[model samples]
Target: MTALTAEGLVLRGWEPGDAAALVEIYRDPAMLRWTRFPVTTAAEAEVWVANQQEGWAANTRHSFAVLDDERLVGCVALKRGIEVGYWTAAHARGRDVASRAVRALTAWAIGNGVTTLELRHQVDNEASCRVAEKSGFRLRETLPATPPWPLPGHLHLRTG
Candidate 1:
């Protein structure tokens, strides 16, 4: 997939130079709170980036580096059939970066034959819900106390 840009953010593939910024973004506490995943080490960050590269190589996933004015702010991806993993740097939140990124990805999904796009967020993440709505994904239902990964979250869908 080619790079896409919208709303002052560029979404493109990972690069070796993006490791440092990506590590910091993933280690940010807000991302941990929102996504319930922790990345505390540079090594873990490298592994994650490598896995992303592998996913791209294998065609199992499409990843992008969220860049704002030449700086890597975060990363987003469409993984495993319209499941989007979006995490922005703590500093990038509240500015609608994730919303813009998701919007571009959703348009691309529709172009690529995706019938439905799913967004799952922790029940407590109001900011995420707002993004989903702004990107045109309607809330479908609340999955009560699911398992392993935070329960009682919401499921939103965008169908065309």
Candidate 2:
């Protein structure tokens, strides 16, 4: 994987050493509250990152670590069918870190053969919606909770 630089943040492949810091980001209540998946332990985060690496190794998913200066701050990823997920440090939100990261990642994804990207946010998550809007995704529609995604959310799509 290649490291991406945009708007003062570094986006790169996951590193084993980034797990602890990733755990810290995931443990923040505000950050966790909106996430589709719940994460409660550092070890879990480590395992998650390890799994992310394995996915990267096999070319099934593309996960990138987001860094500010030298600190691991968050992540942005592309799953099957151009589905995307991203989270920024509680301290990093509202600073355009996500917008920049998304823009860079989207450019990379399209260049790599993804024709469209999809994202979702819970009904009440205006912050997340803002990120998607800022990143150029259009609101698709509200849908019933898909079998595995416990919560109901608004789906958005961006095609380029």
Candidate 3:
């Protein structure tokens, strides 16, 4: 769970030193729109990084800092029940970073005994749908809007 590479991207655990980079990428409102966790300032980003480390220690989450040749570009996280989520830096969008990172995570999870993985994104987020398809997560259902999840979304699943 140290570092995993897919295509030309590196998926590595989030480190405290990465707070600056986290703030940089998360400045994208598109990235903030999907999650309740918002990393704005350096202090906020530091807390976010700390939470990621805590998640790893608790074995409840697997959050990776995506890098392209050592430059931080995004984040991909897999929750305990196998739910997958991601966001690419504004500058890195349209480069298939999300799909490649998800695929790499799926491979690792399946190899480690995970049978299925889930991906969810708002219906209007067409880009996420493309990433889901590219990552081999098939559309399974459209979930009703619920608390914390503001809008109706598609749930895609990938089974080992």
Candidate 4:
């Protein structure tokens, strides 16, 4: 419901117009391979945006569209007050977009009363691990593969 900005990146609430871009981002093989959400169609993208808004309204999650100079380049979110997740657009990769967004979101969440935040990525996702580290999260533990999430992962924690 609120917009945040730093270092030329704007973190804002999702809008209906973002559906196409969301679909584009989701089309990446890596995106589909790493996350649970697979928004392959416009309708699915709409649903994804709607769900984000719904979560925000319910106070269970906060999702932001990461923009670079007004162009959507990624997303960063806090779920259930303790988990943080993010993805960068293919064009935005290597620009430190995810890390910067995570740092900004972490600060916002902590200021809003969140005491701790967690980030987890599949064990092989070294990029995510780097982002977590750069964003001030430290590796905590490794979680065994579960039913839905079929791969082992490292759990990183950052306390406010």
Candidate 5:
């Protein structure tokens, strides 16, 4: 995928060298609570990065590392041209990193022929809700807790 840049942040394809930073980001307690992926070890992180590369090659998904001034700050991804997800490192919170990344990715996806994008977050996660809304997503429905999602969530949608 092409690298996207805006306001000093760059969203680019994941690289093997990014595994260590992925480990640190994924190990954050907030990340652990929100995502179901197993990323506790460097090996798992390597697998995660590999999966991202494979997904890109298959056209099933696109994952980007969010960088600020060349420092890894988070990630944003679009899956199956429908679902969108993102996370910001603890130090990057409160700076609108997630919202900016989401907006950038959303625009890129729509420009590439995707008609809509969706995001779902646990109902209690006000921060996520804000990010989705700030990035132009509207709450569309409520989904009950399921196997992967451990809590009720608000499903948000953005249509091009």
Candidate 6:
């Protein structure tokens, strides 16, 4: 994936060396709760990074590390040209990192011919709901809590 710069932040592909930084970010309970795949140990983090690389190669998923002045602050991803998700570390909360990263990714995806995008989060996660709205996605429906999603969720959509 191409590196993107926006609003004093950089969104770039995950690299092998990024595993260590990701380990630090995933230490937060919020990350563990929100993410499907949690990267707790160095080995898990490495495998996560490798999976991201493979996703990029397959053109099926695209993930970017959200950087602020070269420091890792968050992450964003576009999967299957439809679904989008993002997270901001505890240190970066309230700084609008998630919205900015998602917007940047959304713009790139649209430019590459993606007509619509989707964002979903547990209904209890008001913060993620806000991020989805701030990133220009509108709530489309309520999803029943499924096995992967522990709680009922909101589905947000953005169409180009």
The C-alpha RMSD of each candidate to the native structure, in angstroms, is 1.5, 1.7, 1.1, 0.8, 1.0, 0.8
Tens digits of lDDT, candidate 4, 1-160? 9999857899999999999999999888888888788999999999999999998999998999999988999999999889999999988999999999999999999999989899999898999999999999999999999867878999999999
Q: Candidate 1: what lDDT? A: 0.83
- The runs of at least 3 residues in candidate 6 whose Cα sits more than 4 Å from the true structure, single-residue gaps closed, are none
Question: How should the candidates be ordered by lDDT, best one leading?
Answer: 4, 6, 5, 3, 2, 1
Would you estimate the TM-scores of all the predictions? 0.92, 0.90, 0.96, 0.97, 0.96, 0.97
Error of 1 at 26 (Å): 3.0
For candidate 1, write residues 45-101 as lDDT tens digits: 777778878888898888898889998877788889688778778887778998999
Best by lDDT: 4
* lDDT values for all models: 0.83, 0.83, 0.90, 0.93, 0.91, 0.91
Report residue 86 deviation for candidate 1 (angstroms): 0.6
Ten residues in a row with the worst lDDT in model 5?
31-40
Task: Summarize candidate 5's per-residue lDDT along 57-128 as a digit string, tens digits.
Answer: 999989999999888999999988789989899889999999999999999989998898899999999999
Which scores higher on lDDT, 2 or 5? 5
Q: Given candidate 3, what's the lDDT at residue 34?
A: 72
Residues 89-160, model 6: lDDT tens digits: 899899999889999999999999999999988999999999999889999999999988888999999999
Which segments of candidate 2 are over 4 A away from where they belong?
A: 147-151
Clashes of 3: 0
**True-structure lDDT of candidate 4:** 0.93
TM-score winner between candidates 1 and 5 = 5
Error of 1 at 126 (Å): 0.5
- The clash count for each model shown is 0, 0, 0, 0, 0, 0
Q: Give the number of colliding residue pairs in candidate 1.
A: 0
Ranking 1 against 3 by lDDT, winner? 3
- Candidate 5 residue spans exceeding 4 A from truth: none
